[model samples]
Target: MAGSVQPRQLALALPHAESLSRDDFLEGPANAAALSLVDSWPDWPNRIMLLAGPEGSGKSHLAAVWAGEAGARSTTAHALTAAAVPGALATGALVVEDLNPSGFDERALFHLMNLAREDQAFVLITARVPPAAFQVELRDLRSRLRAVPVVTLLPPDDRLFRALIVKFCADRQLSVDETVVSYLVTRIERSFAAARQAVELLDGEALRLGRPVTRALAAELLRDA
Candidate 1:
């Protein structure tokens, strides 16, 4: 955040992209319900919320925003444990993205639920699919997951698609012309996830060329994609 330049211009430009903030995320029909749930936090009937959507549908983006706003903590389902909960969560909130994406750690999650409930802290979980559709091996965890409030996001629309590409370019200080942007939107994969991946590829190509993006390179990426 301080004295940082573009990643390609400087070998060490903050090293990693900044956390996805509220401004970086674009809202569309696919994301309105998820946005509303977070917007109505603490009054949304349940302090515990579950978010799931297609891969790269901005679930982690929303999770990070919520974590920042609430000063909440998080642990991937892989590393979560009971001892980890009710520590700093009571004063803030807790988010577990990709919950059971790898596999459900039922014992750890169940313990976390009890602790969060006791502490009156918020607990949010996210995955690529709804819990109902999650391929769970543990019956107890499956049953508990079904009871949680699940929010799903639709595939991103054009506005969201454009916004994500622009933000990616802006973040890297890469100057991409309107023609190139339009070309990417039209020829590249249209989903938010696809746009992000395409941007990364295009950004890397721009860095290698040490010049602004041109329609020619974009066309090549689209052609080769």
Candidate 2:
């Protein structure tokens, strides 16, 4: 009993809080137009607008920022129903997020759009692809969606990509220097999703091995990634 060896305990997978406040939103050429549209607010070109972009392009963050300013309600596309439209627009501002053709309720969305126009409530729809690409059975809904003004968020530029890696590391309370970030910029895919993934993997591995995050560590992990 006295010579018994103890098993090593793995670090717990704790959740980290991401800052989605307007100030925390990174600004760059990639998302300038999208940010401008969000900042313009009530002056939107139309009562209902669509924000489209590839995955991890900050559409949700921008929507949150706009929702905060507009005092809007947020709902997912799949969760929306015809009966829910009225309450969804009660705040006079609503964010219908992640609207894809796969599982969305067409009739419900159609009702919401018409109702929003009737009541002059502002609506922000965020999707990975443009509404025009949706394959809906409702012809009227398809036409209506195609007419909604769209603003697209592009992939981030080099500066913003580097900044994103650093910010993601900071969010996980992992202190990483420019060398690590610079090395990641070249090694990882040039996208927000990739930056977040790299940081998460690095954090998990560092905690597992009890090592500090460094360029060498990132090199090893990325080489295996």
Off by over 4 Å in 1: 1-16
How well does model 2 score by local distance difference test? 0.92
Error of 1 at 68 (Å): 2.8
Put down candidate 2 lDDT per residue, 109-168, tens digits, no spaces. 999999999999999999989988778899999899999999999998999999899889
Query: lDDT score of model 1?
Result: 0.77
Clash count for each candidate, listed in order shown: 0, 0
lDDT (Cα atoms) of all candidates against the true structure: 0.77, 0.92
Mind giving the per-residue lDDT tens digits that candidate 1 earns over 56-104?
A: 7878888888887778887787777667666647565888878754565
Candidate achieving the largest lDDT: 2
lDDT of 2 at 29: 96
Worst 10 residues of 2 by lDDT: 5-14
